[model samples]
Target: MVNISSCECMPWYVGVFRIRQRLTEEHWFDANCKYYTHVFDKTIISQVLGAIKYLSTIPKYEKCAKWLNENKQNLSQYFLEGFKSSKPLEVLIHGDCWTNNLLFKYNSKNTPVDLRLVDLQVSRLASPGSDINYFVYTSLTGDTRSKYFHDLLEAYYQSFSKVLILSRRKLPFTFKELEDDVERTKIVGLVIGLLAIPGIFFEGEDEIFDFGEMTEENMEEIFH
Candidate 1:
């Protein structure tokens, strides 16, 4: 069973959200744009679309694939510009909150007693929902997520509330607002899963293409 308390730690440092402006201008925008351009030479978008098309052929991913296909155009826009739409209740989030990026500590009985997040390189200001959605979608099985979605949200909010009370601070937003934010930004999870989960699970011995050797010419070959 996935421990819900593992997610409670996300909102512990509310002060991090206050530094959004400097981080956005000095770090996220520059790094994100340069990453999309210079790293993949602007071919990452096409590769993502190709990956989505490939995913649509998988039986287990049919529903997710349908949603990805339907919203692909918006997803392309979000790839670079999603930060612009951050809500007023935004917080500094673990920008890459997938399964591999999280670490859990188990007690003597092997029950997860603690959690730690890794890879702070991509951390940025965004809705707490962004992290929640990404982690829930990418880490949990669909049935698990469907069963415990509300419980997870409740646990997260309770944790956030306890932290705020201990820090003598006001609740930044109501639970309803959090739910709305999660609803609005659910696409962040789906889009990220579409781009990442395939590569993580790919077991083919063939080298897809070296990032160092990537070019517009060979980028399309990744989907083949």
Candidate 2:
């Protein structure tokens, strides 16, 4: 596998403006809309917003809910700019690292022996932790993530460290630093999961929603 942590060069065509447009305009939020707008499916946007609004009602997440509500308009912009603000270690990352984008090949014994990542359109230069956080939060169950979070970090660090050594590149960051990066970039995972997971399961043509029919009350019901 390539030592992604050490690789610095990106394609000549990939520029900051393109990354900004992808993050701000094409993917999550529509810049033209005054309110928070999801670019892909309006129904999915409603569900995500409804979920956020629902969370705000709960006492425990009040602070989180408050922050999200206060910053809803700027959330997409924040996500785009966050890469530049706190990146101690940078690497080319598979921007969308969810389970569906991954394909695994199994041996005769039914054990997986090989892996491939698809959907390169969103790939960009960013912290390696962004990919890790996105994968674990979106792909794995909450229970699994909570229990094996540290173990997962350790495994990734060991593998990455080995690759760097083999390639004669100095290790860029310590294991602790990796953990910190993961923690710092975790909102990327959470935001993505909230936005994308609903659309993943609502696949049937019959389940398609009429955007005109959506309202505050029914939106929460749809999310539930």
For this target, which candidate reaches the highest TM-score against the unseen true structure? 1
Q: What's model 1's overall lDDT?
A: 0.64
lDDT of 1 by residue, 98-212 (tens): 7687677778886666567788787876667777788888877787788778987887777777766766777778999989888877767766766666676778747344567
Q: After superposition, how far is residue 150 of candidate 1 from its true place, in Å?
A: 0.7
On a 0 to 100 scale, what is the lDDT of residue 22 in model 2? 26
Off by over 4 Å in 2: 1-48, 56-64, 85-88, 206-224
Give the candidate number with the greatest lDDT. Answer: 1
Query: Residue 14 of model 1: what lDDT?
Result: 29
How well is each residue in 150-211 modelled by candidate 2, as lDDT tens digits?
87677667766666676576777798887888778877776677676766779696776675
What shift in Å separates residue 39 of candidate 1 from its native position after superposition?
7.3
